[model samples]
Target: MNKLSVKVKNLVIGGNSPIVVQTMCNTHTQDIEASIAQCKDMVAAGTQMIRLTTQGLDEVNALRVIKEQLHAAGIHIPLVADVHFNSDVAIAAAKVADKVRINPGNFAQVHKDAAVQFKKFLEICKENNTAVRIGLNHGSLGEEIVNKYGNTPLGMKEAVMQWLSMCKENDFYNVVVSLKASNTVVMTEAYRLLHNAMQEDGMLFPLHLGVTEAGNGDQGRIKSAVGIGALLKDGIGDTIRVSLTENPVNEIPAGHTIANFFESGENEILLDSVMAQIRRGSSKPEAIISVNSALCGNTDTRSQDAWNEFIIKASCLFGPLLLDKQIDDFDAVPNFSHAHNHDHECEHTNEHSSDHESNDAEEQIFVEMKKIFSADRLVEFKENLMQAARRKFTHPEYIACPGCGRTQYNLEQTFNEVKRRTAHMKGLKIAVMGCIVNGPGEMADADYGYVGQGGHKVTIYKGKTPVLKSVPEDQAINALIKIISES
Candidate 1:
């Protein structure tokens, strides 16, 4: 980890400081009473910081009043003014608020001479001991940057990089940064690329992780969990805010849940393991084979219905998408196991065969064995048996996650479609995961990953990093086709 720390309103952030939990108030900032009430409510829910939208001078005035009210009432929460398209407002808010967030695109558009405006803005923030967050939203990058980088993750990182450079050039380092998207994969990868860029530049400004427009209810919670949790597991985020369509208070615990899970005393190793797995992308071949073989031949519990049970259990280990996207509950699995062990039959036939017609007998035994294992055994044969035995694969390995509350599309159907299209591309291990949260860590060994990023959107990845993002539901499959064809 790079050496860096930032101080905001008496609180230390970045480096080894505990991950901060934040949430933005949805109440209109101009409505002073409503703003104070909502912000207080959020603080009660454990939000360490609060962001309020300051669209213009009026909101700045409202922020000042809200700050006063909180102080008079004996509360000491740091206030952040979210300003876009208004450097004058940002300058004013910076004088009062603990932090002022400005969009690089908005600053460039609002001030004709952005260099002069940004210099003055930095001066005000520096003087007031106010921190700055050069917020970059994926859908809001400037036209020139878009033309150059194609509204992609690279474009998002470049937009922030330019501004970050400006701050450093002016000798201003009290900066936090955010590179966000509604799409989880894009958001996660952009943060990763930006983090690495900062590390190379020797700047470890704390990152604020979020997935914008994460809609309400259980859907919102799970989506935020997957994206935020994934990053936290890899030790990427410093502070986080769960962006939701509901009341701002609802977003607090979601962010806290992720922070809490990774920060748990016992889960420290789990987090480290996830990061290592993602970096290496695959484990030793011997290790994987040994585990699979042991799983396949569990002699400790061999019974009347052992073989089928073994196949089902092994399929569940890799995921049931191989056997067909159905239930995996052990109780519901029933007596799918077979009455006899097929491997012993081949050996017995070989031993009893007469010398005169040995080849024909062997052929007969082989055909019968194939017939016995052929039904409901396509997945177990290629993925389990052949893979464990280290033999040549007979089919392309398609790995996909069963859908969860966070999943946006019909994952089972999508997996089938992907397999139907790419079954001919043998010897490849491709993964399809429900969301970016698990895609990178879980599918580390896969050659490619097709992950759900947002509603009706997919992000295609070459291993752990994203290659294509925010492809529409209709075109994502085709985009995947292009990735495969090109690769």
Candidate 2:
């Protein structure tokens, strides 16, 4: 990934810079005493940056006081002014704040003369050497983006792109960007989309990541992990603020924990939000899926009880569960377990009770992922998530287990070889397995199977029936591709 270095006061972001953990103060900004105390606490808690809300003119002076007090106390972390609509306040904040965070959607709405306002805003930021973050959110994307792409990830990306384009026009390079959503899936997918687009355009401004309106407690922490963790694993983020609906101080630890976990090569670890909204308002899901989120204990030299605890937590979440298939904001990679039972339960294999809703959901996932991962796993997702699988898969459907000791051959290498050759072919179900006993049975819905027969040999199946027995491992890749193309 291409990295860009951006200066916010004394802190530099991107391009070999350490991922900075940030927190925002929940206290009213005009309350200088409370703001100062919180800022001190945040700085003490290892916060790299502190964000304070600047809602009006009064808060502008408040920012100055907070900065002065923090500086007096010898804390020099960059202060970011979180401004929504008031560019007047934003301009005042730039004079005092190290960085000014503006919501482009609301900023656009408030300033009808966007060109003039942005030009002035950029001039002030440049004059002061104050950085800016052009943050966009799903709920606040304004007329231009909503008109073009609706309230979706693409809209969020285009919204930021429009602002970034304006920043370029004004010769403003001290800018960061964020596209935040409460749903981890939506948030992660949005970052991936924007990253690709920016990389293609050679734009590598540091990115600020967060899950907006993520509610309190364990759910908040797990969600913060899933959304931000996904991108960090992909090496896409520069700074992060885990927006827990709790004390801002709690957010620091959560954000830093996520950073440290991803940094230590725990990339594949997933936290299960279980795709539930906690039955918001009066609305209720027909059934309840109870999943207590867990993380592998954070230490070296822990007992196997730690590993046992990990399995126990995971098993309880997915145990004896059937796919009620509650799709979250996006097609998140986290696998969850949920049992199905309720008054409104209906059985229809191919269709949900609500076709329009399902179509909307499926279409949204398809359009979003098409931008982010089509070259990676978009093919498999199209087959599984969208209904296109019923018509004909546009990509190969692959299944492989993390092999065990009973396995006869090297499943990982063989699976890779098979996939490498036939990844271009569509509408084929291929299975690669470690052991022969459960392997063939597990290939239940697959169109073809490649199970280990013995050392360096593979059994190729046409549907459920074995068509070729004990083919050489070297010949298996060609054999699988040949069968798919021929069939």
lDDT per residue (tens digit) for residues 1-487 in model 1: 5657777897776879998888887666877888889888988999899888787788899889999999999888888998867778989999999999898876786678998899999999999999998888766777788899976789888889999899989999888899876555667778888888988988788888876644443334444554565566567888888765455686776666557656754235433433353356532111010111232234422232333333322222222111111221111111223433555533433343442156543233333333234334433333443332223365665555433334467665777788779878878877777666444544535788788887788999886678999989888888888997898
Q: lDDT tens digits, residues 200-235, model 2?
A: 889788888876644434434544555665577568
Q: For candidate 2, what is the lDDT? A: 0.64
Q: Quick one: best lDDT, which candidate?
A: 1
lDDT of 1 at 294: 30
How high is the CA lDDT of each candidate model?
0.65, 0.64
Q: How close is candidate 2 to the true structure, as a TM-score?
A: 0.58
What are the clash counts of all predictions, listed in order?
A: 1, 0
Q: Return the TM-score for each candidate structure.
A: 0.58, 0.58
